[model samples]
Target: METRKGLKPALVAAAVAAAFAAPVEARITKIEITSRGPAFGGVEFPGVGAYERLVGVASGEVNPASSNNSMIVDVNLAPKNARGNVEYKFDFYILKPVDLSKGNHRVMYEPPNRGGKTFGPFNRTTGGNDPSSTTNPLGQFLAPRGYTMVFSGWDKAAGTNTANFNATITLPIAKNADGTSITGPSYEYIVMGNATTTSYNLNYPAASLTDKSAAKLTRRARIDDAATVIPATGWDFVDANSIKLLPDGTTFAANDIYEFSYVAKDPTVNGLGLAAVRDWNSFLRFNVTDDSGTANPLAGDVQKIYTYVLSQPGRLLNDFRYYGFNQDESGRKVFDGMLQWIAAADGLNLNLRFSQPQRTQRNRQDQLYAEGIFPFAHQSTTDPLTGKTAGRYDKCLASNTCPLALEVYSANEYWVKAASLFHTNPAGTQDLADPPYARYYLMSSHQHGTGNGTARGSCQQLGNPLNANPTLRALFIALDQWATNGTAPPPSAIPRLADGTLAAAMPQSGMGFPNIPGVQYTGLKSTRFLLNYGPQFDSGIMTINPPATVAPFFDNPANGKIYPTFVPKTDSDGNDVAGIKVPDVMVPLATYTGWSLRAAANGGPDGCEGSGQMIPFAKTRADREAAADPRLSVAERYGTFGQYMYARGNSIVQLMNQRLLLDEDAYAEYTAGLAAVRAGSLLKDE
Candidate 1:
């Protein structure tokens, strides 16, 4: 890889030359570029001119004998290439400026969330999977800034490969030392949305498809209750990887918890996904070509690398750092900075035998998976409950390879994903300050995804449509400036125990939620428990399929014996009192809550998975009194559209001054909001 002009010549050349020209160990052997064409149909970005897209397969190998890969669960048992290195191949996609001179010396890497290429709120474009389409303004924001965008597959079970976004990896299955099959306890849970749904594809194939004796099927009324075993005769194995209820016309209860636990075989070397990401990013940044001499597209252009991952894949980023995958084979840093979006306190259910990377336990379904465990914080600290001390950056800190991190999550994370554990101690008694290298921000009064702020779906209340994208765009710029220049970002804007904003989640525990008309405020949250998955749990092997739970000592008085957790306190309008105040939350048209209960038909009273409620205030003061609504009327809060715009504009200006909102985003949102307000679409006063 060559150094671009304008950088410190001696330093850049010396560093890159030594890394690339030196005798290589285990690295990317080949990059087979399958397709090459103009991105966005030859659309020219502002200063970057036109960008080109490169889609390909990246083949790499890792030495199992090396200490760098020893943490991989079954690396020792994986099949090796002729060079005695464990081999892996994954699909990759890259969009870079056609001319290197016109590019910024940075790579914006987005690891696919379950095989889909999403920008994680940074881009307002729809169908972000297809970055090459001219119809969609995909990559319009970053491409103009001359950023080289990158993506690649890491999950082995990335089911179907869409033409627009196919990022799948191939990994070897772990076997016994004698080359025999290895099996482990695998569990799958299903909640039928309707009665007609009968079959489910298991995470892994059953060890013995014919042997129904060992496999057990059970049903429970709720996620927390004890499950009653459904007799084996009530179900049949449709195949090695699927199951169906017995008697062709049989149906399951709409919201009942159906659990299946069995001995599953052929576990992929799932942990290799971490290595794949590390090495690919390393290759793009430092190497000019692979061993096969396939040119590294952005080899000379990449001086800094940053990653943005959302939801499940965001959890993967957490696992990647925890297991020391941030340091490549040459002991160099992989990502210079990381923006982890929406993955709160949970780690991925990966890096273990029979790994289920997609399992995320919500308040209503998929309960008790191997996630939301200890070592939730980035800084190493002692867990008062488990008596263990560790952190996500422990390994990186020891190796001097820790990346600057920014953890951005929404209110849903606080309600459903145990986000409080990310900022607090394991016992939740006190808030722990973030490390100097990290910043944590909360998207106040927002849900997991953007919504239209309407009453629809199976939830008991109207959907929350608080858009956090404007704030996200600003923060991303802040992160880039902090990493590229010496400029520090804005202070973390999260609720804290030190402040009065962070409080108990339940209304009974003094959350101070307002009583809106026709709204049920049960204050249900996804409870965390101290789980024991047998003695081998720490070693990434779960001997017990459904682990036993142990109550923590620091118990919550409101929830009885359970792990302590907290949520951000609410204002009179039910919006979160803390965090970056967006325009919608500032001006206020309705009360937005992070938790929304499922309707009676689905599962009444349980918090809707990843959903938040938007209960509109009454139109007029008379309407509020007539409906017995405790919340004030929208007209009373803002007499006219002019007042509404004034308030929202003031809020946007404040955020801009703090560098928490960009000018372009602020202007766009203000105009759009003003239009809606003028049309009486945003605030109704009939």
Candidate 2:
């Protein structure tokens, strides 16, 4: 091949001669095109119409007979002009894939025709379809550009007979002034239902009609332009027994404030089984650092700003979105107009801040806590009524109240409770312990972190098991009413407990405990200790070395208190104190509550037992077996138990606030304001 700029002109000429020397065969493969017109609703075009035309091109070249063959030829188009037969001269060429020796074979068109009757080979530079030309614009563009447009004929598959057909034309590049060839790019175009095709008879020009258009305008209007408002009217608790109240007589009402703090610790470092360190680290990075490196403002800052806005009297805090619960980074921007509307309706002032727990060194207790494993102990307090030393020594950690700093508990005890209390619940209720103003909503299929579930509903469902329910819409409606009318929304309808039980209405006179039965207690020491043991450690008992035993404890109705006694010593030489072989010291224990506990009193066949089993042991057969079977892992099973408990706790907290914290009427008014704002109608008056 003759080379110019690494390309050959002589070789091109010879190839063109060779192509014409032998009759070449080819086939039409694929085609596509577009036309200008008014946009239809769902369909591509509205009604049948055509306007001024624009530029277009058609292109395709002869395929090689074999992998190694190449050829070309001179091309000509004849037209019957007024002066008689007129001929337009053109050229053609053949191209093979770059690495033919390596068996790679493909074809491409290079620099099309230069100046026969056409100014350039491609329509782009050829000045063909000028929209401004009022008369014969389509003809001027198509004819000179050498585009053979075609219209669709009746096809059984397509009901209409007027679809457009894409066109392709193949020809060679013409020589430059120096006799060297001008290499240009290949070109292709589509003719709607108003142009000609090569297959159409020359005499029947009308039959060659293909569609073409000059210009068309398209517009998109926003349909769902709206905002989510916080409700003005406070929530009401018709069922008085549903919530608890505080001593001050203030209750949980609308617009009341609360704070929440949570720590998302890294999963235990187990040589075997799935470790949570990766996910925990990810959560920390998302919440505390800018992982995206975009330096976007932290969610905490946004929350603070929102709180500041809400603090202003009569202000609605609906413009802001919050996240970072369970250390998940998720949220959205509200419509600016919506923010203005809220401000105008309620006047604004509130403060929000992201609370991050201080990281501390992990202790042996922490390690055991992470694995959901712990030592069992029964602390007994002396009962004034019971004269005898009546106490039961048993493992009570298996109960639902056991405390463990697991992710599930972190979500429930912190995220759900805090969000419900401050963000969702109403104010002005007698209850302070467990306010009833807020409704606790749990996504049926939410994962550990927010947005780790499906993205079907709110921003919270950003991750895994997605729920396609319309519950979010309901929440919005309920929130709107609660904020405006002082009418608190009803608690979410959930599955009944195993005992087929239902909780009482809110605002009862007496203290109310969590529905977790024996789990409910006011003392922080018991709450934390019990929850850590019950859910975190005991839950993983079956996987512990030397299979553990499970025991249940119930409160003693007779004495009204729990008592404990020391375990018997087996050694013969050991001093026998209390008649039996046990020690004289008395251990504290509670009455036998219905709750059950699992313990390994003696080292079982699996490995170690009881207190020794709680140690981090990846070498044990039990640990290895549990790692291979997901059902055996504490994190895998009952992981959401803590979250549920937390939500329940939050519900109670809100109810209590409404009954005890604020003035009744003032609480009602505040709740009404919130409802109005949420309903897209903020109250103007104080």
TM-scores of the models, in the given order?
0.94, 0.16
Candidate 2 contains a number of clashing pairs equal to 173
Instruction: Name the runs in model 2 displaced over 4 angstroms.
Output: 1-436, 449-464, 468-470, 492-527, 530-686
Regions of model 1 farther than 4 Å from truth: 1-12, 19-25, 136-139, 547-561, 679-686
User: For candidate 2, lDDT tens digit of each residue in 1-686?
Assistant: 11112213443453334323322222111122233221111121112112222122212222322111111111111112342321121111111111112111111111111111111111112322122222333322222212122111100111111222211122122233454432211110111122221111110011111211111111111111121211212111122112112222334322111111111111111110000111111111122222222221111111100011101110111111111111111211111111010011111111101100111001111111121101111112233322322111111121211111101101111111111111111221111121232233322212221222212221211122211112222233233344434455544322122212111112211112122211222111111111221222222211111001111111223212321111111111111111100000011000111111111121111110011100011222364364542112222221333432333344334533433111222333334323423343211222
lDDT of 1 by residue, 1-686 (tens): 22333345664575568555665556788999988998878888765678888888999989888888888889888998788889999999888889867787788898898888878357656546667664754445677777788999899878556476678899998889899889888888888888788788888888897887778888866554666777888898889988889886677778887878888988899889988999899888778778866777876667789887778888999999998888887788899888878888889888887787767877776765788788888878787766899999999999999889889998999989889989998788889987989999998888887765656577888788887777777777888888878578888989999898987765533887887768887777877777666689888897755522212211333223356888999887788999877887887777887777888777676668888888877788998999998888878888876777778888889989999887777788888678657665545433
- The candidate that achieves the highest lDDT relative to the unseen native structure: 1
For candidate 2, the TM-score is 0.16
